[model samples]
Target: MYVAVKGGERAIEASYRLLDAARRGDPAVPELQVGQLQQQMRLLVDRVMAEASLHDPELAALALKQAQGDAIEAVFLLRAYRSTLPRFGYGEPLDTARMRASRRICAVFKDVPGGQVLGATHDYTQRLLDFGLLCPDAGHAVIQAASGAPVPDAMPSALAALAAEGLIEPQRPSAGDPEPPDITRVPPSYPLPRTARLQMLARGDEGWVLGMAYSTQRGYANTHPFAGEVRVGHVPVEIVPDELGFPIEIGEVELTECQMINQFTGSADVAPQFTRGYGLAFGRSERKTMAVSLVDRVMRADEFGEDRTSPSQDQEFVLPHSDNVEASGFVQHLKLPHYVTFESELQLIRALREAWDARTTVPPRSVEPSTKEVCAK
Candidate 1:
C-alpha cells in the first residue's frame, strides 16, 4: 500500500533555506537595512509595534525583516520575542492633558487651543498615485520651519467643554489606589471592564477593529459618534520605585489618543447626556485609536443599560476573536495532519451507505439454497 504523507525533516529544512534565499531576492541588489525600514517605513514599524504590544521600534524593524514585510507576522515575531524578556515595574497611567503634541485635531470645534496642528497627515491627499515617487528624490517633501511664536504647551480637551456644560457625562476621579489592569499578566474573562477592553483593542488586529467599528456606523448597535478630539504626541512615563516612595519620569513615548462623544439616553437621576468613548495607543496610530474608541462605546452597551443584541456589543464574541495571534494559530492549524480523524469519518460514511443499500435493495431470494434443500429433503 502506498501511503501518502508530507515531506520529512530534510524537506522542511530545504523549504526554510529556499524561503531565506527568496527573501533576499537578487544578490546584485543590496539587502534592505533595518535602519532603512525603521526610518523610511515608519508607519509599518508603528503598526507592528502597536499590534505586538511592544514599543521597541528597533525590534519591530528586525521582526519586519525576518517576516519579509508581513505586518502580522512581524507582530507575531515581536510578541514572541517580548515574552522572553524580564518584567520591569509598571508605569503610572498616562495623562494626555500634559502631552507635548506633534499633531492635534478636533472635529467638534473648528478651532481648538493648539490651532489644530496638522502634522504629517494624508487626510486631504488625493487617492491618485504620483508616479513621480518611483524616483528616490521625488519621495522627499520640502522641509520649511515656521518662523513664529511658539504654540501653547498644553491644550484644553474638547471633552472638557461639553462636560462643563452638563451635556456629556462627568469625568470622575479614581476612587481608592487602584492599579491599572494588566492583560499580559492575567487572562481576560467575561464582562470585561473598560480598561481590559481598551487594552485588548489597542493590541488587536487593525482590520478586525476597523471592521467592528464600521459595523456600528452601518447600524449594528448604532450610536452616532463625533470625533471630539484626536491627538498624537509624546508623554512622559512615570514609575514609582519600590525603594523610593515618590514617582520619577523614566522616559517618554509617542501616543495617539482619541475621544469620542456619542448620542445621549436619559438616565433616572440625570438628564440625557452624551456618552464618551476613549482610546489610547502607542505610536501615531490614529486609525487604531479611532476604531478602539468606537468599539469601546459599543462594548459598554450593557453598562449603559442598552440592548446587547449585536455582535460588536457581545463581549464574548469580540474579546476572544480580537486577538489576531490566537485566531490565526487556530485557523492555520487546519493544515496540520487530520488523516486519522478523516479516515474514521470515511469509514462511518461507507458503513452508513452500505446499511442504506441493504435496507432498500431486496436481496435475491436464496433460490439455489432452496433448490438444494428441496433435493436433499
Candidate 2:
C-alpha cells in the first residue's frame, strides 16, 4: 500500500527514466532508424496504420519504434496523435474498379480475365525457414526478387463476370442513402448499419478479426464462401474542394481489397444468387483483409435471413470487443490501485466469517424437554 500510494510523483519520474534506459539498450549498438522500420518492418507499420485509421507510414514507423515494437501500444500512440491533427475534409469513396492491381487472384474461377498474378506472395514457398537468410545479402536478394515483377495491364474482377450472368446479387444504396455515422466522433448504439459495422471492423484488431473469421470457417456460422477475388494495388483518392464543384485526384494509397462470394439460396421474395462480402484496408494486408471479408459475411446473417446463433454473428459481441486499444486499456487497468474497493469487500468477508463461526460454535440450544417426554419419564 505504501509503494502503491505514497510513491506518487517521484516514483513515476524514476519509472520513466528506467523505461528510457531499457529502450536504448546497449549504447554500443547503433540505434534503429525510422526508415529501417518503415522499409524492413513495413507489415507492422501497415497493421498499426490500419488499426489507428491513419495512413502515414513514417508516423506509424516512429510510433512502433517509440513503443519498442509493442503493436497495440504503437496503435495507441498513433491514434492519440491523430486526434490532435486538423481534418480538412472527407475524401470520396475510392473507385477500386480502376485500380492498378499488382497482385490479383481468384480461387473460384479457373481463369480470370487477366489470369492470376502472384506478385509478391510467400504463399507458394515452402514453409521451412532458409538459414541462408542469416546472411544479410541473402535476405536482400529474396526481397529484391519480389520487386519489379511484371503486372497485368487490365486486372478485372471475377465477380463482375458472375454479376453479368445474373448469378450474383447486386447491392444498391438505402433509400435516401443517409450519411454513415462516424463511430469515432459519436458512440455507436446497437443495431448498427452495414456501413458503421464495416468501419468498426476495419479499424479493429487484426488478430481478433482473424479469429472471428476462423470461427465461421470452423462451422460456428453457416457461411459457405469462396475467394471471389483478392487484389492488391494502388487507388487514387479524390476529394472535392469546398471551393471547387467537382472532384480532383489528391494522391494514391496502397490498398488490399477482398471480395468473398457467399452462397445465398434466395428467400421467398427473391431468386437464388451469390451474395458478396467485402474487405478493404489501408495497405497490403491480405491476411487481415481476407479475415475481415469473411467476418463481414458472418456479421450480415440477420439481413440475409440466416440464423444468428454463432458468436461471429453477434454484432454486440464482435464490434465492441474488436478494438485492441480499448480492450488493452480496460484489462491493464486491473494493475492500478483499488484499495478502497478491496477494503470494502474485505470488511464484508470478515463480517460474514464471524457470523458463520458464531453459528457453528454455539452449543445446541438445550430446549426444555418436551412436555410429553417429561411426562413419560
Candidate 3:
C-alpha cells in the first residue's frame, strides 16, 4: 500500500508537470493570448460566464485557458474567483422588449411583424463538413441586406397577440415590491420562489437542463408548447447610483431570451388559456435558454396544480442536483480516504459474526434416551 501510494504521488506530480509543459507547447510556438480566446471563442466564453454567474469575458477566457478549454472547470474557477471579489450593488432587471435583436424567430407565427431575421445560425446549414476552412483565403464574402426592406429593432412577441385575444392567462403586476432572493447569499429551501428557481436554472449544467427539458417533451410533464419568441440580441444593463437617483446604462450584454407558450386547462374562475414559461441567459445560447424555459415550466407544476409524477417536477431533486460544481465535488469525494470508517465497519462485522456463531453453535450435552428409542433398540 505504501509503495502504491508513493508511485501514485509521483505519477500525479509528473502528470501536473506534463500538463503545464503541454499548456505552453514548444518554446518556438507563441503562447495563446487571452484576448484572442475572448474574441474568437466568444460563444464558449459566454457559456463559461453564464455558468460561472459572472459576465467578465476576459476572466472567462483566462479560466478557459487555465482549465485547458474545459468549460465546467473554467466555470468552477470563475465562481471561486468571484467569491473573492467585492460586491457592487445589484443592477435593475433587464427589459427584453427594448433589446436590439440580431436574430428573432417565432414558432407560433409564420410571418412576424418585424419579419424573421436569421443571423449567424447553423439551423438551416448542411450537416456535411466544409473542406474550404482547411485552406486560407485573402478575400471574404460580402452579405448585403435586402434592397428595400429594413429590419425592425425588435420583433413582436406572439404571446402579446394571444393575450390580446384573451387566449392566454393574464400576468398581473405585483402590487408590492419584492426583491429577488440571491441564492448565493441565502441557500434555497423547498417550494422555491420563481426568482430562485430561475436563478438555479440559469446556472444549471446545460446538458442536464437539456435532458430535463427533453424528458418533459417525451411525456414526462405531458406538456405541449410553442415557441412564442426566441431572440438573441444586445440589451442595455442599467443601475441606479447612490448619488444619482435616476438609473443609467452601465453597459450592454448579449443575451438569449425564450418565451414558451404552454397550454393550460380551465381552473376555477380562470378559463382555459395559454400560460408562458420564460428563460434568459448571457449570450446566444438557444438550447440553454430553451431548456431553461422547459424546466421552468415543469418546476411550476405545483402552481399550475399539475401532478408531480416526474423527476423534472420535483424541486428538491432538480435544484440541488443541477449544480455541476456541487455534484462533481460530492461524487469526487468518494476518492478520498475512507480507511477509518471502513475499519470500524469491519470490526463491527467481525464481532457480529462471532456472536452469531456462538449463538448458532450446539454444545455437546448428556443425552437422555427416550422410552420409544429404548424400546426400538
Candidate 4:
C-alpha cells in the first residue's frame, strides 16, 4: 500500500477556516458587536491601545473584533494598521495638570486637597463569581436623580503641594538652548536622557514594568517610594497647524499619570532632598504608570547617591528589556528552525561515544610476547 505525505499549506488553510468558524460560533447566538465590545470591555480596549500606542478607540475595537478578543494579537493588528496611516502632524505635549480626572488617589496623605476621588475602580469589588450575570432575569434598575453636586475642577498635584510647603526641592525644567531628545525617532543611548526614559516607560510592557516596580518594594532597592499621586482621565492633544502657525485641538487621549516621591539618603556635604519619579502613559493604566514611576526612581541611583547593585539600577538591563513586543518576538523566533544545529551536535556526541568505547575495549598488540616465543624456538 502506498500513502501520500501531506504538506503544511493545506493544514494552514484548514486552520484559518476553523479559526473563522470558532470565532463566529452559533448562528442563533447574536454576534458580539464592536460597539458592545468597546463599551463593555473598555479596560481591555484601553490596555490594547496603551501598549499598541494608537489612540483611536474605534480602530482598537475593530482590531479586537478581528483578533477574536486576543489582546496581544489585537495590539499587533492595531500597530500594523497604525503604521500604514499617514502622519499629518505631531500633537502637542498633553498637559496632565489639565486632565479631566475620573479617578485620583494619593497614598502619602490621609486626606488630600482633592479628597481621593475613587471614581471607577474594581479595587473594592468582591472577587466571588457572579453566576446571576448569566441569567437573563438578572435585571438592573436605573436611577434618575436631580443634579445636586457640582463636579470639582482640577486641583494642585501633591508634588506641587510639597514644593509649595518647602518640604521637597524644586525641579527646574532645562533652561537655555537645550533640545530634549526624541525617543520615538532615535534609539536610546546611556546614560539615558530623561526624555528617552519617559518615552520608554510610556510604551513599556505593563506586566514586566509592574514586576520591576514591585521589586523595589521587596527590597531590591532601599528607596521608600510613596504614591504621591495617581490620576486617570482624558487630556486634549493639540497640533500646530502649519498654515495657521498656532496650536489647534486635534483630538483627545485618555491617560494615566503617577508621580512618586522617594526618600533620598544624602551623602556627606550634601543636604538630603526628596527626589521625584514620574510616569505617564497613554490610557487609564494606573498600575503601569505606578510601576514606571518606581522603575524611574530605581533607575536614578547614581544621582540619588546609591550603589547600582540591583537589577533595577542597571539602566542597560531595565530599559532594554522593558519592551514586550521586541522580547516576545525574539524569544518566539527560537521555535522556527534549529534542526541543522541540533544534527551537528548529535554527530559530535556519537563520534565521542564511539571513540570512548574503542579505547576501552581494544588492547595494544603483544609484540614482546611474539619476540620471546621466537627466541625460545
Sorting all predicted structures by TM-score, with the top scorer first, yields: 2, 1, 4, 3
Best by TM-score: 2
Of candidates 4 and 2, the better by TM-score:
2
Q: How well is each residue in 256-361 modelled by candidate 1, as lDDT tens digits?
A: 9998889877777658989888888888899989999999998888667788878989888887898898888889778776889899999999999999998999
Residue-level lDDT tens digits of model 2 in 1-377: 23566658798889899998988889998898899999988789999999999999999999999999999999999999999999888899888887889889899988878888888778999999889877666776556765565676556677778888989988677558989888889799998888898888888999999999999998999878899999989899999998998999989898899989888899988689898888988888899899999998888887778888899889999989999999999998888888889999999999999999998896877788899999999
Q: TM-scores for all candidates?
A: 0.90, 0.92, 0.85, 0.85
Q: Score residue 349 of candidate 4 by CA lDDT.
A: 97
Which residue ranges in model 3 land beyond 4 Å of their true spot? 1-15, 25-30, 136-150, 173-177, 345-377
Cα deviation of 204 in candidate 2 (Å)?
0.5
lDDT of 3 by residue, 1-377 (tens): 22235477887789799999988888897688999899879889988988888889999999999998988889999999999999889888888888898888889988777888777787999999887766655123423433335567766765677888999867663336467789999978788888888899999888888899999999999899888889999989999999998899989999999988899996786689888888888987898999999989878787778888998998888888889888877887777767788899999999999999999999999999999999999
Candidate 2 lDDT score at position 368? 88
Please list the C-alpha lDDT of all candidates, in the order they appear: 0.85, 0.88, 0.85, 0.79
